[model samples]
Target: MTLNSGRGLLAALGLLAMAGSLPTFAIAQQAGQEGTPQAVPVVVAPVEMRPVAGALDVVGKISAIDRVDIQARVEGFLQDVSFEEGGTVAEGDVLFRIEPDEFEAAVTQAQGQLDAAVAQQSLAQVQLDRAQQLLDKKVDSQMTRDQAKAAYDSAVAEVKVSEGALRSAQINLGYTTITAPVAGVVGRAAITKGNVVGPASGPLTTIVSQDPIHALFQISETDFRNLRDRASADPDNVKVTVGFSDGTEYDQTGSIDFIDATVNQSTDTILGRAQFPNADGVLRDGQLVRVKLESGTPEERALVAQGAIIADQGGLYVFVVEDGKAARRTIKIGNTVDTDVVVRDGLAEGDMVIIDGLERVRPGAPVLAQPAPDAASSGQIPAAETEADAAPAAADDKG
Candidate 1:
């Protein structure tokens, strides 16, 4: 072959080799691009409509409906203590017995005097009758008959006086036995047997009714005005629930029974009272508790899981999926009920709020959203969220 033909042949071979490798390189580059990650996976829930109440929370104290102090009415040595300390008692039940020797003797003396007066009155009546008969026959003077009549009147008056004395003596005798003035549970006795007791003596014991208890609380003037306005609009809407210091909630619900007519000058607050049916006797007098009051009729409000809420310098916000993209929205918040918060503004029903994978989410970022596990059974997002998720929103909103 010629030199030029040899060179052309070598060039043709080189060209063919380069063409053979180009398709493999192109395939590798395409595979690498296809392996890149997709949008971040997230859990989301839909906003819901629920009935909500404007509620106020405050500290309160439990008190009894009826309380009394037991004291002696008469003077005598306490011969016997007839009741068990810290036990239930009924009205008119005897609690103590004082020595009755002196009182009994006075009663006996008064009775004897009354009997003697009655005999004297009988004898005087007989004498007056005889004197009247003699005067009719003109055997006795009119002066004698007049004297007999005066004696009979005097005896009648004496009988009445004796009767009064007897009644007084009997009352004093009855006072020797002390009885309970009301039905309730009695406290420890201040006086025991052999102690002298009288009206001047201090209270011997205390008794307090055990059922239908009262819960007393105080509210600021502003809150009181709001409550009064709400009450005026709906009188039967105010309801109260109590919680103990140990984080236990009371089962029975109560109603507001009283509000003080005058405001307290020192605190600038008003006193309020709620009545609770304490059939179980779980409540006691002077017990500190947490009181929550909900007033006004139930109204429709938008609610979202607390986890879905977010916060920034501007205000509280949340991320919602729109057209498969995360959209940041500012929201106004209201009272918290359970795991959900009432969204006063900026959210609508059926809006999908990002709950899980919040750390990976950003405003305007694309997301692959799925219902949270708790909401899977309902075929939608849950109505409430964990309290930990709600904390940031509360702080940002200053709620």
Candidate 2:
């Protein structure tokens, strides 16, 4: 019995020694794990709210309300183009003068004849009066009185004929000078000095009325109906602003003045015109421009930085960080402005978005969001790098 007990004690001692060696083996495994480094951190931003305005925009053209082609009215060699090409002129301004010396001489000859006729008429009247008085006193024959009366009448007719000739000559003389019929800025003079021009001749120049200019644009019937409905419903007036082809907005605002009564058959578009006070004459006729037609009461809208939008196989999307993980979200977008886009759906205020290091993120990846290092320094990021993306990624995880 004593021998058996001694063997059992020795077995228990060996088992204890093996258990101590097992702890050292576990320590080596733990040391190896501690040697590796952890992943780097990512930055993110919370979803923020901003205000936007509702607007309707379309491409339009600028035009002069009144455009005129000036034609020559007098027959003569263009003595002098009194106004410079592309100069402003007023009504009754003389444009050109024809040779008038021949017409003047004709008038002088008519006047001389009229004077001689008057003198002859006076002498005939004296003779007629003397003959009449003699007849009254029975001192002369009736035939003699009649002859004097006939001479006096013939002299009066000669005087009347001479007066008619004088008036005709004077009128022909006045037709020599041509004058401006309207006030406006004149275009290139088609006829120069010494060029023969007449009433039958073609246009001499063109004139465009610059003040109270107009902007012309066509919109579909659907758009027109929308505008009309708004105008009728609201008491406030509809306003419009214009932009040039190069994306510069004009400094003026215009009101809708004229709308076509019927839609165009071929185009199905309604013609509309807006007037502006272009006193400086900067807006030219037929220049292309973009017009924003705003109607109804303005409403507040959700706007995101333009840089925050992303595209994928599905559609436009953005990334947001939530609970320290990246989440992807799809968004419905609306009008885009200078550096922002109006979001019609799929986003809200106060959501955290991932803007920086988007490439390092994936759906459901763990993230450590710090103040986006790049974002803190610069607020203007590319569309892909805006907070709208990061906030959705962060907030989407909650949904």
Report the Cα RMSD per candidate. Answer: 12.1, 11.9
Candidate 1's residue-wise lDDT over 101-215, tens digit each? 9999999999999999999999999999999999999999999999999999999999999999999999999988889888878999899899899989999889888788999
lDDT of 2 at 328: 86
Compared with the true structure, what per-residue lDDT tens digits does model 2 show for residues 60-120? 8988777777776546666676787778888888766777777789999999999999999
Let me know the TM-score candidate 1 reaches against the reference structure: 0.61
Clashing pairs in 1: none
Task: Please give each candidate's TM-score.
Answer: 0.61, 0.57
Residue 258's C-alpha lDDT in candidate 2?
Answer: 83
Backbone clash total for model 1 is: 0
